[model samples]
Target: MSKVILITGASRGFGKIWAEAFLKRGDRVVATGRNLAAIQDLVNEYGDRVLPIQLDVNDREACFAAVNVAKDHFGRIDVLINNAGYGLFGTVEETSEQEARDQMETNFFGVLWLTQAVLPVMRAQKSGHIIQVSSYLGLITVPVLGIYNASKFAVEGLTETLASEVKAFGINVSLLEPNGYATSWSGDSAFQTESMEIYNPVKEAFQQAASTPGFFGQPEATAEAILKLVDAAQPPLRLLLGAFAYPAVKAAYEERLASFEDWKEVSEAAHGTSIKTGN
Candidate 1:
């Protein structure tokens, strides 16, 4: 049976592609964004199957109302993909306190509110999937994008724990980690704070990297991977999409190993166990 899906940030990027893919597969979709006009084409083409909803995830009341509306319209929401987010670019020192808070509010709290709103319905039905769209930076951090990275890292941690918490309720929570997808991430990357005399050259370099097209992973690629993950009989807890994510994760693992070896004695002492017997 085809499922009914509600995707945030459906006006563009991966969410738009995801809405199209789900509709293409004969599933009913509630495509949502702050501006419904952007998804007018989907509504025009798919008519009743693709319902374009105007919503802003950052708004708590709106988030609840949107979930209620989708549930009321579809009878049940088989999948809720939390895809509304943005990027922040700057070193930690250069980023403003307000920008950091805004990043977390949208990226972390927005997902949290949406999940909370939808989970009750899913729990009542005893089945549904919650897909939280994070970034590769969720697992690994890079310089200059500190605040954005921190927000994603918070999502990764929250979703990982939520997956375990919701398992018994017949709800599956998964993290979607896509690396540098050709979305508006780079172009949309906002500088939280104006550069002081401290690091103008470094700031410029960071801006250049943010504007570089070579690092973008195609949005369709992430969209397709998300479709596959959603369709799987047993979806993974974390789906790392795109080429950039894989290598980045691998490198992060290797770095962890190196760090562990360097602090073997301390780690062993902390655990109150000898290194002789391996678990």
Candidate 2:
């Protein structure tokens, strides 16, 4: 059976690539973006297999409306790719109030709302998959992307809870933690805060890291992995994209584990003795 997939940010990057891949494989796609024209090419090329919608996911009501529209148009939604977030480049001290809020609104709240909207639909059908496009930064923070890291971290927590809660309903949730990809994301889709003199070295380091060979994975190669995921009998709750993600995340977790072990005495001290039922 052909699956009906709903993709946000379907105009470009992985969203566009995966949307086209699904259509080419004879699946239907509800392709959405902030601008209608941005997704029109999908409609023109794939014809009835794609439904292009103009949606800004931050609007709470619009998020619900978009889900309804897709459900009404497609009859059922088998997969949802929350792929509509951007990177905010700024250190913690350099980021503005507005910049931080906007990052959460899209990267965090946007995913929350869309997931909420589709929950009922998925529950009714007893099957669906939600794929959140988080980053490896969610697990390990970068100097200049503090706010972006926070947003992905929030998504990480949210989606983990979602996975456990929705499993009984035959719904699967997955997070795509890509290390980096050669997308316009670091180009025009990115937002950079005003530079500060003190953070120049930090900013320079980030730029240099981005230019490193193998830092950014080829986005085209991810289609097979995605296809395999959605087709799996049991899809993972987290899928790390790119060759760089696993080692990076593993090292971060190892460091974190070391800290936890180091603080074991303090942590257990805080707990004190176990409470007695007789008391």
Candidate 3:
């Protein structure tokens, strides 16, 4: 019953907690991060049960190599948690082209590369789960995080399509859309663009909204939820974690639906009805 779970970004936050949780439940874990030192303690504590590898998700070759390492060590990988990504804070205009590309490379293309590496193995075995750690921003955007949102939105689309394509192979793909959690996600791990004086007011308001202090979800709880998801007979394609995620995502979709319906007539008018007797 003990399965091999490969987790990227296992050095800290939700990734670290999830790794520990799996270890506690007697599952084998291949924990990878850009910094080996970050996962050294886990390797020390869990010994052979944990394999800590240095991996930069943004590197395509490195992603494939890491998957090979895991497969070699564990014989097979049952779960892959794509948790390697950072928050990029800035307006679309404020973020540099390089910064935007970097964000996409890590958050979107990284997931794609890793998934591609693992799919062959899973396809041969006829069973596996791929979990993408997306964000509430994937569903709806807020100010100053457009690049980050774009990356996650890309992830959302990628994983959803992947799920449909691989269902016949017994592969389950999921997107975890977590809202604010008590993690370093907003601190050291986050990257910010050069601040513009004109956008200071908007930035200040966004910061104030984020800083409101109550009931941020804990990493451990999120880990537990993920474990439950992993054990379920049928896991969902999209899951929202944290208390804030549900209401916020629901409201966002509702508003989107309302807007679409309001414009439905105009949208339909754009295409005239085809004339009959064309045959």
lDDT, model 1: 0.86
TM per prediction: 0.91, 0.96, 0.96
lDDT of 1 by residue, 135-162 (tens): 8899998887888899999999899999
Q: CA shift at 229, candidate 3, in angstroms?
A: 0.8
The ten-residue window of minimal lDDT in model 3 covers 270-279
| Model 2, span 1-279: residue lDDT tens | 899999999989999999988998999999999877878888888899999989999998999999999999989999999999998988999999999999999999999999999999999999999999999988898899999999999999999999999999999999989989998788899999988999999889988988897788899999999899888888998899999899889998999999999998889789879646774
Give candidate 3's total backbone clashes. 0
Q: Candidate 1, which segments miss by more than 4 Å at Cα? A: 189-192, 204-214, 270-279
lDDT of candidate 3 over 52-96, digit per residue (tens): 999988899998998998998889999999999998888888999
Against the reference, the lDDT scores of all candidates come to 0.86, 0.92, 0.91
**lDDT ranking, best first:** 2, 3, 1
lDDT of 3 at 131: 95
- Can you list the residue pairs that collide in candidate 1? 180-217, 182-217
Better of 1 and 3 by TM-score: 3
Ranking of all predicted structures according to TM-score, beginning with the best and ending with the worst: 2, 3, 1
